[model samples]
Target: MNVLLLNPDALRGSDPAYPLGLAHIATAAMKAGHAAEGVDLFSENCPETAIFSTIESFQPDVVGLSVRNIDNQCMRAPIFYLETAKNLVHTVRKRFYGPIVVGGAGYSIFPREALDYLRADYGIQGEGERAFVMLLEALEANSKAFSFPGLTRRTADRVEWIPNVPLASLEGVWADRSLFPPLPYLDAGTRQFPVNIQTRRGCPMECIYCTNPWLEGKTMRFRGPEDVVLEIRSLSDNFGIARLTFVDSLFNHPTSYTETLVDAFLKARLELSWECTYNPRFHDPHLLSKMHDAGCVRVSIGNESGSNLSLTALKKGFEREHIERSVLDAKALGLETVCFLLIGAPGETKDTVLESVCFLDELNPSSVVVTLGIRLYPGLELSSIAAKEGMIDPRQSLLSPAFYLPRELEGWAESFFLDEVLPSHPNWTV
Candidate 1:
């Protein structure tokens, strides 16, 4: 079977993310005795032209599309990305008459909704390496036994979903980077465009607004430290890539694993600068110092809000002190710190917002990313709370952008941030 995987993410002004998930699926397909090719729509000036050309040339038996993000997640002037995907699917349909499968982080969040909306034949909910290969094999065999984990298909009346079983280990699974070369992605962006690498999967945190647990599962799965370092070495040696960003949901969780990984980087003598997100719950100065020594130049802290009220409301297990400690420690290590503030959570108020602004000002991070309202997803605690508070209808589909902001701050928050917070803080971006 020949499989053609397409990345349908072309968000403007955002960094072009390497389709690592599609690469992994392609690798899995090839390993399972199938020919696989990948086409990145973001790399082409005209995505429709690229899609038509690829389908005409590749003539794949099956086409797979990876949806990276549903939206830009910005409350103000939000950019919905699914329309582009729908257009791509229409284009693919015109060129080829084969089964189209959809998968990736964005689609996984709303498997049935996205699949039906895009009018794709099938969708994979969770990890795609094994499920995708199985899907291809089943398709090749012309078997109707599609009752497998993470696989979804829409029947006449309904969309059937099978719960996904995440891979227990990531030992032998490696992304086939050849399908989507690094040069195209590297040349498309600035020098700071870091190639993304995932050392682990899963997040155990109970952040109310996060989708990591649903997308990657709650169980922590780690790849061998040596294997990860070798991948980095190959990237550097083959592509002359020096910068990287870990896409792990919680990079510092299980402090022992993080320390060991940092040690591996030091032992390998890889002269590459990298950055990763840090959970304030695992803030450790000693480990951070080691990471800096291992060529870590920056750290991003997802401290949604600096106010304790907002933190508790969002179910962030850490408090204001923890956020302060994390930022201070990273700054003290001479590592650039990027702190995120998710404004307008459930219990947001003028006082809480002011507290967050003051706290961030005191911390003085290298960069501050401010998001106006919390984007609500189905089955999330925030979603339920929003419904209860009458912010959004309970039956409303979140496939379209819906956000939760306190009624008092609806028209006031954006103005306040734009007028006061952004002007005074030169490094802050919304």
Candidate 2:
């Protein structure tokens, strides 16, 4: 069987992320004795034509589309990406007559709904490396009643989703490097193409508006630290890429594991400068020092809110002091710190917002990202709160974003952030 993996993500406002997940699936498919190819639309100037040409050239038996993000996730100026995905699906269907399967972080968040919305024939939620291979084998056998985890089938009336997939072992899972975007970083000027690497999957933290726990189960699954080093080494040796960004929901959780990985990196002397999202709850200066010594240049702390009232309201489990100490420790080690502040969550008022801004001012992170409102996803506590407040229908397909912002804060939040907060703090961005 021949498979074509397509990455339809072209949002390049920030650093354009490579389709690492699709590459993993493509590699898995090839290792299973099937021919696989990938078409990355991220760097394409003409995506529609490129898709048509790829289909004409590859003529794959199955097409897998990886949807990385649903919306920009910015409540102020949200850009929904599913319409572009839908158009891409339509284009592919018009050109090719094979099955279309959807996967990736965005699709995994709303598998059934996304499959239906994109009008794809099937979808594999969660990890797709093993499940995708199983799906291909089942399809090759012309077997129906797909019983694999993460597999979903769509019919005329309804979409049937299989059980969520267990965490896949990273023993031999790797993305095909040859299919990656070309060098010189086209849109991202002067920014080194830091390859995105995932050392683990799943997040245990249950933020009120998060889909990580739902998309990837509450339990964390880690790849061997040695295996991670080997992957990084391979990418550096083969592709001349040294910079890496660990895309785990929270990379430095389980302090012991993180310290172990850091020690391994230092022992290997890989000369790889990497970064990751850090959980501020565990503020260990020793760990921060080790990370800096092991070539960690930056860390992003998604503290969400600096106000304890908002933090407790969001069930973040950490208070302002944790964030402050974490930032101070990282700065002491000369590591660039980026703190994420999400204002306008439940229990957020003008005073709480001010408290958060003042806290950020005191912490003095290298950079601060502020988002105005919480985008509510279905099946989350925020969704229920929105329902209780008559903000949205609980049963509504959140495929289209529905946000949870207090009525009183409306018209005030946006301007306050734009005019007052952002301008006052040179480091702040919305």
Candidate 3:
């Protein structure tokens, strides 16, 4: 079987994320004796013609499209991305007659809807490496692959989704670096950001607004510490890529796993600098020290709010004190700390928003990223709350843009930040 994987993400606001998921699928499919190639649309000029030319040359038996994000996740200026995926599907169909398959972080969140909307023949929801290989095998056998876990299909009347079995082992699944273009050059100040690598999958945190639990499962699974170090070393040696960002939902969770990985990195003595999203609730001096020694240059704390009222309303496990300590402790360790805060949640108001701003002033991080409204996902608690509060119709498809912002705080949260807090605190941005 010949498979051509397509990465349709072109948004470069942040660093151009290496298509890690597509690379993994390509690796898995190739390992199973199938010819696989990954083409990043962002890296190529004339992407539309590139797709047609690749199809003409490769003549693949299957085309797999990876959708990284459904949207920008910005409530203020939301950019819906399913249309892009749909366009890619149409582009591939224009020249090729093959089974079109789709999967990725964005696709897994709403697999059935994405498949139907993109008009693809199939989609694998959760972990794509294993499920995708099985899909190829099933296709080769001319048997039904829809029953396989994490696979979805559409019929004339309905869409069917196969529940994925939780893959606990990270033994052989790895991202093939050669599938992507060489790492781009960055200046000294921003060079710390590099291509992303994942140490694990899944999240246990039950933040009300988060879709990580729905996307990656709730329980955490980790790659072996030595395996992580080995992959890092390979990246450094083969590609001269030293800096990386661990794109895990939460990096420092399950302290034992983090400690082992950090220890491995230290023992290997790799000249590396990295950053990760940290949940402040698990901040420990020993762990922080180990991470610093292991070349962790920065910590992006996922403390979404500075006010306890908002924290409780959002079901953030940690409180304001936890965030303060996490920031102060990371700063003390000489690790640059970046704090993320959400402005308008369920209980957000003038007083609570001010309280959060004041708290940020007290424990000043290296910088603060403030987002205005919470983007609502399909199965999250925030969507339920939105429907119950009459913010959106219950029958509405969240596939389009939907956000949870208090009606009372309408026309106030953005003004307050842009007018007062942003001016006083140069470190804060929306």
Candidate 4:
């Protein structure tokens, strides 16, 4: 089977990501004795004609387009990426007869809505490692793939989803970091092409503002340290990969995982610089030291709110002290950090918003990304709160891109961050 993997992601919502999940699927399909090829719409400036040409040239038997993001992750703005996605789907619908399937992190979150919106024949949710290869096998046999794990299908009447897949063991597919294209660095102006290697999956923290607990099922699992080091070095040697972004929901989960992995990378002397997100609850001084020794340059901390009132409302287990200490420790150890501030969650008030500003004032990191809106997605604690407060439409699906700020707060929350929270830091922008 000739497989066409499309990474339809933009620079804002998603990085020029290496299409990690797509590559895994392509590799799996190829390993299963099928010819696989990939196309990334991220770097391309051309539109339909170019993609059509590429598809025409390749003439794939099956097409898999990876939708990495739904919105700009701000203002529910329909990203340009979606228009590109819809155009590709419609173009493929008219020109081609092969099956069109969708997969990726953002696609998994709203698989049914996205499939319906894009009018795709099928979609896969959760992990794509198993379902993608299985879909390929089914396509080769010219049979239905409805029974494939983590698959979703839309019929004339409604959208149907299969059972969620179990956590795939990372033994075979810990993300072949060699396949990723060169990506532009966010902080550094330098051009870097490194393969992304996700060492762990799923976070145990149950922040009310988060959907990870529901999406990832609160399981914190890490691949073996030796396996991770081997993959990183191979990627570096084969592809000249120098940087890595540990795509773990919370890379520092289980604390010991970070310590062990950091020690391994240092001892191996891989000379690889990696960035990741860390859980705020952990502020171990010793672990922070290990991170610096291991060549970790930056870590993103999800300090969702600066106010204790907001923190309590969001059910984030850690308080302001935990956040403060973690930032201090990371800075002390010479590790750069990016702080994430999510304002205007449910039960947000003026006082709580101020608390958040104060928190930001105190713990100014190297950089900060301020998010003005929140998602009222189904199965999340925030979704329930939105329902209780009548902030969301009862008929709309959570994936329909609803913004959950209180009606009273309106633009106040957005402007407050701009006027107050952001300017305090030397290098901050919304």
Model 3 lDDT tens row, 46-157: 8888898888898899999998888888877788888988988998999988799999888888888888999999899989988999889999888853478998988788
Per-residue lDDT of model 4, residues 296-393, tens digit only = 88888877878887887788888898899888888888889888777776678877777776677678788877677786666677777777788776
Question: Which residue pairs collide in model 3, if any?
Answer: none
Query: Candidate 3: lDDT over CA atoms?
Result: 0.85
List the candidates ranked by TM-score, beginning with the highest.
Answer: 1, 3, 2, 4
* Number of backbone-clashing residue pairs for each candidate, in the order shown: 0, 0, 0, 2
Selected candidate, larger TM-score, 1 vs 3? 1
Clashing pairs in 1: none
The C-alpha lDDT values of all candidates are: 0.89, 0.84, 0.85, 0.74
Best by TM-score: 1
- Rank list by lDDT: 1, 3, 2, 4
lDDT of 1 by residue, 228-298 (tens): 98889878887888999999998888899999999999999999999999988889888999999999999
Q: What is the C-alpha local distance difference test score of candidate 4?
A: 0.74
Please give the lDDT score at residue 62 for candidate 4. Answer: 82
lDDT of 1 at 418: 95
Candidate number with greatest lDDT: 1
With candidate 3 superimposed using the best TM-score fit, by how many Å does residue 341's alpha carbon deviate from the native? 1.1
Every model's TM-score: 0.97, 0.96, 0.96, 0.91
